[model samples]
Target: LEEETEIASWTENGGLFVGTNAERLAEYKRFAETGKYFGIESHVLSPSEVKEVHPLLRIDDIYGGVYSPGDGTIDPTSVCNAYAKASRKFGGGVYENVGVSGIEVEDYLTAGSAPGRRIKAVLTSCGKRIETPTVVNACGAWANEIAAMVGAQIPLKAMKHAMVLTEPIAGMHSGLPNVRDHDLSVYLKTQGDSMAIGGYEQNPEFWPDVDPGFAFGLFELDYDTFGQNLAGHMQRCPVIEETGIKSTVCGPESFTPDHKPLMGPHPGLRGLFHACGFNSMGLMLGGGVGRELTKWILTGSPEVDLFSFDCARFHPESVASSRWVRDRTHESYAKTYAIVFPHDEALAGRGSRKSALYDELKSRGSKEPLDYDLYGACAESGLAFWLVDQGAYEEGAWRLGEADHPDIPKHQSHEYLDLVEGELTFDWPASHATVAEECRAAREGVAIFDQSYFGKFYLSGPEADEAVQYLCGADIEGKRAGSVTYTPLCNSRGGVEADLTVTKLQDSAGSNYYYFAAGGNTATKDLAWIRKVLEDQNFKAQIEDQSEAMTLISVQGPSSRRLLQSLTHSDMSDESLPFSGAKHLEIAGHPLLVLRLTFVGELGFELHTPAESAVEVYRAVQEAGAKLSQLEGIPVRDAGYRAIDSLSAEKNLRHWHADLSNRDTPLEAGIGFTVLSKLKRTGS
Candidate 1:
């Protein structure tokens, strides 16, 4: 950008992140390892070595630090101007001081039975209508407002961020690198002869309402709130204690519920895209974001695996709630500089969404009935089942122990007291043994998992078969109805966009419909991808998102078929409902669509039941498991996600976002069998 635009927008002053404790220092070491894998230049420094790099540090209590020589600061204003100038040079118009008043959309009839909406024009505040087929909502803090005009939403909120500049120091220079004391949540940046100091507060104030004419606006610095960071700044850099304050700058910055930027096409509207909600890292990530977003706009997909930052990651209902957005945004902002443990779960805005069998699962292992008012009580009780966010719903993950475990406290007066803390760690947690037990059950006896969070969808119409064949890498040409094919939805470059199962089912009227089961977190993203493909190809297929209406209960192990047969009147023989086959069965007196498959390398069945009947079906399964346990001496256990991970890992089952991503091809990930033989021969 600097070579082409000739804009001096960046200063290569390097950056340093220092740790104050051993745990944080260990985290730095792990980060350095990751940086090495990515071919990034990074060095782990001791306290004395850190001081050598930056002499201003008070390293007596500091453990260590990590320094990146290539990490530097950029001038946001200059970069923005450079982008505008470069865009104009490329025959792209750069409009400024123009606010979008409304988005014009028209409902168009498609070859399919359902109709779709398309962007027509954009109404501006200047009373001029800009006729365009696409509009990018890169409006920063006001992005949600722009999305609202098109009847779409993004989970973003604006918060007041304040920083202070100290008086010119006697020996400060621009060559000094920026310093970050993450433990203290304070940072120092060189500003000519002075320094700019800022920090992320534990409880930042949210700006729910922003004035329409508040562009480039500043708010009065709240000394009371800013004082929390000011003390840390002085403590980290003692020289700041003697230096006088020059000025305080407070402004509104946008943030998201998960702290990741929202970048993708709008799931609901065609030709509408989102590129905002950077959570204060816009300036740092703008260049890459711009490059990738340009590719996404030109082509139908991006090169990188951006599922983590996809705009459709959040549920529309969750983003629509103002209180949910504020609470989670505050938590996300406060943890900007905190160590991210592998098992860390967000504590805010929970309990709002739950599966149908939430209560049934909670009551099974608890010593006493848990209270609904106690937040995270199940996590600390005798059951020790930790509930985690699975998209919009709370799903149980790991169990520390059973009711009879010695680690659990026997007595408790207050529900919140005697809670087990520090369960979120990078090392082996106390639940390791419990998870191993659950894995044993899945490998030996029967193990049941409440997989209600799995995303379910249906695709049927005149072109349903063609759409599936075109989108999937596997050859589904001759697969009969009721056959399940585990395939990867590949992009044009043969990258694995989504790894899931497609079950072919025929209705009573003899119309073929395909059922899709995907990861809960990637539901919206996968759905949007399918819709985009359908629109681009003009396929007359009707897609329905049944994620909220259906619940999935997985039963796996050597005895899984026997256990399921006891509960249902369906034929248990391989010839009747063979492996990788679907059947409509009556389980526990409730209708269910059962699919025979396994992620844990065992015989398993996935019961797809209505949400309302999930609790009853789960209860019936547990009761049958108890009876089978007495007869066989091999217990049927209730498994959590942790156990699922262990079981799947043993089988080398690839997870969508973790083991496999959009950056990898099915062949490279050791799943070449899922790809078509012709494509492999052609090297496509």
Candidate 2:
């Protein structure tokens, strides 16, 4: 912009982030850590140093600040003009006062007899057809509508942001440093002799409809809604209240679900690309964004991990509902200057996907699907809890106040740490609802846990046994009907693919059958891997995913048999249904497939039932347990995954994915005893 002369109005003034509260100051420290990670030079300054960095900021309420010395402000209008001039200079067409009416994509028949969708041309509102091999959708706020024309879902939400330019003030020059007071959620910069202040209010206005007519235009002044932010700005810089009224400019900026810009090609369609959803950071990142897009278009990939900004990262539910986008966009905008820690999930727009027993679980204080239900339930009885996200699982467990679990590993990988969603903890509860008490109940009494999310599959056909034997490291032929065995699916290199329990079922007319159960977190990967392996081996076995249809409720501990026996007419003795035995029976008038196995090293049975009957069976088990507790003094309680992990660790059980993964073999995982030498598998 400086050298071109065609758009030389752009001048640079540095930017500063100042904090006025301890929480926000800590946020600056975290930002400093992030800056170091990203190789950005940033310094955390004291209150006195903050004044020296920016004299305009009030340091009385200020705890500290982060100063990005190289950060600067720019005039976006001049930058855009410069970019357009440069594009034209480079022989690129620049269409002004024009809009895209539609995008035309043609499907080409492929060798596999499937059709490939390819962009053919762009239909413009000016009655022009731009025929090109490739098209870039850089429609800014209207990018979503353009993407929708091509049947692509883009989770972009436009929010109305307002800024006011104060009347010219004495001593305020044109080259003052741009300042951001994060605690107040306001920013201030010099506009000639005047000042420009803007805020990202907690509650933001969503502009979901951004048609062509609304393009490059500002919304009318919303003094009523903007007053909250104005108050915050005036409080940060009290001097701003004295300045006379000036121009109030309100415009819309597009935001993605994760607050990062979408600057790559659409994961689905061919010959199409996206560079919109800047989350209001377009002006600062425009040049780099252009370079990134250019590199991606030319070379087919970018260097950095753009998963956070991937346009395809969103699920259909996230983009299909305007309210979801609006709620999340508001969260992103509201926390514009707030520090978000790792694995911090957005609280808005939750539970879009629910299980069959969602209402029953919710009635039991389930705030979320799997992660929060136990904690919320424990809270009802006055329990103190700590939640552990992906990174801090091991450490967070130790940090639990007065933690009583002595078996929690300090050095090795903990399987509970493998949880993608954060794990709930009732450790050191203020009441009797502690994790220690839960473990005790599972060991000395009876404990039940919702294990309905386990990955399940049914394999049948005449070659089912042979097919399973070829893929599993264990001997599948030896597993007789009504029996189960814990085994690992291994690669040719003898590395474990997954640890699961395979149960041999009664053969039907010339076909053998088996039921497989794997860990919940690895459900999708396990299913896909199994299907691929079966396809590669050319097995004639029929496999079906029963994960969503089936539910597994685990009732374990010494009194588990009695609790279950109370609800069933079947024999409960070990002689009748031995350990590792599988039985098809009825509980509370509902059909169920029960497998005797234990992850917690205690006597346990996994009652597998249909989704429709899950709630009834669970309530029956609860009632049976309550009656058992009253008569036999052996109480039955719901146990969280934490207790399960603790008990598993005490029994030296290796957790799938965490303790044993594709890197570990059956022998290396200390489970070679489970692998029989009679039938040789691929890994053997």
**Highest lDDT scorer:** 1
The CA root-mean-square deviation of candidate 1, after full C-alpha superposition on the true structure, stands at 5.4
- lDDT string for model 2 (1-684, tens) is 557646675555666788776657776787789889889888888988977866666778778878876666678778878888888788887778888888899876433223347789999888999897578888777888888899987778877878898998776776666788877788888787888888777666777567668866888878876887788777766777888868989987788766888766664466788889998888877777788778667654444334345464454444676665655566567767665543234444444434465567557653222432110111111122222233333333242311333555677764333332232221232223356777898999987777766778997765788888876777877677898888888766567767898998875563568899987655544665566466556676756788778888889998888788878889977997899998989998999999998999999899989989999998899889889888888867877666777789999998875577665778888888767574344345
List per-prediction Cα lDDT, in the order shown: 0.79, 0.70
In model 2, the Cα lDDT at residue 132 comes to 73
Give per-residue CA lDDT, model 1, range 1-684, as digits (tens). Answer: 888899979998889999998889889999999999999899999999999888887889899999999888898889988998898889999777988899999998666666788899999889999899989888888887888888887788988888998999877788888999999999999887899999988757677787767898889998877887888888888999999999988988889988999897888788898899888889988888888988888977788878778887776667777766766777678888888876565555665556677777666743212211111112212124334332112111112111222443344332221122344567876566777788899999988877766779999998888888887888776689999999999887778889889999888998788999987667777887887787778888978889879988899999888888888777977999899999898987899999999988999999999999998898898888998999879779887777777789998999887888887989888898888574765454
What stretches of model 2 exceed 4 Å from their correct place? 1-14, 78-98, 105-121, 126-136, 151-153, 167-176, 190-194, 244-246, 256-274, 285-303, 311-313, 338-353, 364-610, 620-684
- Candidate with best TM-score: 1
Off by over 4 Å in 1: 366-383, 386-420, 678-684
C-alpha TM-scores of all predictions:
0.92, 0.62
